[model samples]
Target: MPKLQGFEFWKTTLQEARYVVAPMVDQSELAWRLLCRRHGAQLCYTPMFHAQVFVRDANYRRENLYAEVCPEDRPLITQFCANDPEVFVQAGLLAQDHCDAIDLNLGCPQMIAKRGHYGVFLQDEWELLEKMVKLAHEKLSVPVTCKIRVFQDVERTVRFAQMLEKAGCQLLTVHGRTKDQKGAFTGMADWEHIKAVRKAVSIPVFANGNIHHLTDVEQCIQETGVHGVMSAEGNLHNPALFEGSSPPVWEMAEEYLEVVQQHPPCTLSFVRAHLFKLWHHTLQIHQDLREELAKVKSLEGLSEVSRQLRLRCQEEIAKEKEGAEERPRGDLPFPHWMCQPYVRPPPKVLVPNGQSQGSEETKTESHKRALEDSDGTPDSLSKNKQKKKARNPHKTFCLELKPKYMKCEQCGNPKGSKCVFDLCRACCKKKAYKEVADCPSHGLRFKTKADRQRVEEERAGAIGDQEPPDGSQGLPETHNTEQEVH
Candidate 1:
């Protein structure tokens, strides 16, 4: 096959970018991108920016495209969501100097995209989509690529990939979900369809969806025959997904915080999203701590909350070692917190002739075996057991009392709740309350005696006569419900 447009440059990049960090809205900021690159991500996309916003709003360009692009951040793709060919070309030309390639985001399924008439909403306008890509190919100095959602009709999906290639897209990212498969309807990504798309196009294809672990990267490539794999939620939860080791969530959190601090001036909202994702699985179980972390505004406040959570996680691990039931190592993968988690069947490695090689043990199982092989006991298990047995009396007492310190004086519930793990009746009845319960600082609180009085005074001043307010809204809850698109 003759090369797709710009294949000369894209092919060189594909050789090293087998594992990519997907472009995410509000989440894929520079700080997080740098963090993912440190772990093993070879290619990273900036969050999907509206081309119109990038073109018209000087401040948006300065803020969103403001990251200090270092040599280590090479082969970056700046993705834009646009439906107009002329405006999009203008956006691409502006961005081409900063990135290796400019990507058209054709796969976002958010309601915002439908309202804006971009993303997957443009899928049916094949002629317009091609013109947009062709315009960028002709106008920009760098290569043009697109990330698109699949169609319900397999034939149409294949045809769409072929059209993009013919229209001068040098690289293609195929998200396995259709435009309608969003939010609660986002079922598993159909890799079989992705394989079909790969067969129909000459351009380098990257698969997205059902990728939540490091091993999933290799599995997606082997199963779909795509040149690369892309991750969003998986990398957000474990920025170390490409590193092939399941380090504890706090360790990952600490590493991310260090990178974020070094890259100063990161938006408070962006920093909060990364923090919640890194601790989502464990923190969900402790609503009190989750709520406290949400209210943090500065890096210092975030750092203190993270430190407290790390200590809490250590305590949980110790309790499990002493009396908790044997459970899977590491908290369940982030997807498990949603409905029943998708347990991927082992991927079949294929030989050159396309025959199935054989099924192999999953990465999780292999890791377990490796641990068991080391001195006949998993190192993590052995180490925890040794710590449980050998910890000094004073340290153990402090760890045990930490939770008590976080409890309220009057209600006896923690800072995240009014009742015991539930809200008190009066507070719950308030019309001002969003479903998330208040900590009810009135007449009760955590930490020092002075802390309780201070909270009580703040509540009195704020309440006066009107209903007490729910704290000023923090970062909105991130609903990364889709696999392929934003």
Candidate 2:
């Protein structure tokens, strides 16, 4: 049968989904997708799989997409990150049978994505992206789609979307942030860029980012004129965000755990991460349970910890009802026990006087600063580096505080302090082999070879000094003895 494309594919195969759960790395597993689907999610994407790995590794394919014959996970899209056109097509072919469409990931901005030379790193290479999408569209039975981060310039972003559409991309998901807008700098997504891309493309467009609630989804569609709205971090915190209800954290947590139970062999780490996001606000109030959640190893253990947390929250709720406690909601619109969006605090900016502008500093930042003050290291050092220095005070990372390293005479590399040849390990090995010498400091042993040679020489000399078996010192003496006997 001929494959569907563009609006026909969107309307028929996808049912014109408007509320989409974005493709998260480890978080959007089969169990989580099913849970979100039950809570009114119109569509979902499988976690982004490495194209090369997915093509070669059968276990990866089974564990991710073909874990079971899940009929409920319909109208799904399997996404992949790839830089090669052929490999991307191969992966798409492998995944196309299972999903309604195959999505090329051009939205990831993590350091891993950068190192792998895929994802947003390939955004500037328009030719490669075009070839990859076009090849997949030509080869696979399913429609080809792309999820991309916007360029800083709106015109360029719109042109990029248009190019994808021309290259056989049936659908496009435009995350309204540049590649650089990630981590702590993930300020706010620009709806203007998404709106522009929606205008430029003839295919179905999905607007991603800045969606924390169902209201945001409605507002985004109304503003951007896109067919759909996708959410990642917001969905993680509140799975029912699309349902237009902020359910209790325990309710979501327990339901997710139940869904996880149905999907056997679901990764414990993924389940743990989901629980952490669900109980993020509550964990702030009950820090002890947070530790327990992190330390849990099994699913039952996670459920038990969740149950304990539920009891604690119920007790707090009882107190609030009786007017015995006046718990402050702080910045949260609802109480901490309810599921809501986790608003990322803005990045702290440093003033000219070396003080941060924001009075509210994270615990990690404060710990890092305190460590720096005591260790005499610059505050510019990373938090991890500061923590490492605090753990091992004697270890010096500063070049000024480090002991002088002696250079090898033969090579410029650093030499062992106790090396007899005064050379690096490589140079020392060569010199030792040539001179029949031993360098114990460098673990290079040449003495055994020399000893074997000496033994062979001594054996040869001893054989030459030995008398004949007939007791004849010379040939003349042997001849005279024979004549006297005659």
Q: TM-scores for all candidates?
A: 0.67, 0.77
lDDT of 2 by residue, 301-401 (tens): 99999999999989999998998867899999999999999998764653354357745433211112333343456475676776677778777666667
The candidate scoring highest on lDDT is 2
Cand. 2 TM to true fold: 0.77
lDDT of 1 at 389: 39
Off by over 4 Å in 2: 347-486
Those runs of model 1 whose alpha carbons end farther than 4 Å from true positions after fitting are 1-7, 321-486
Candidate 2 all-Cα RMSD = 11.5
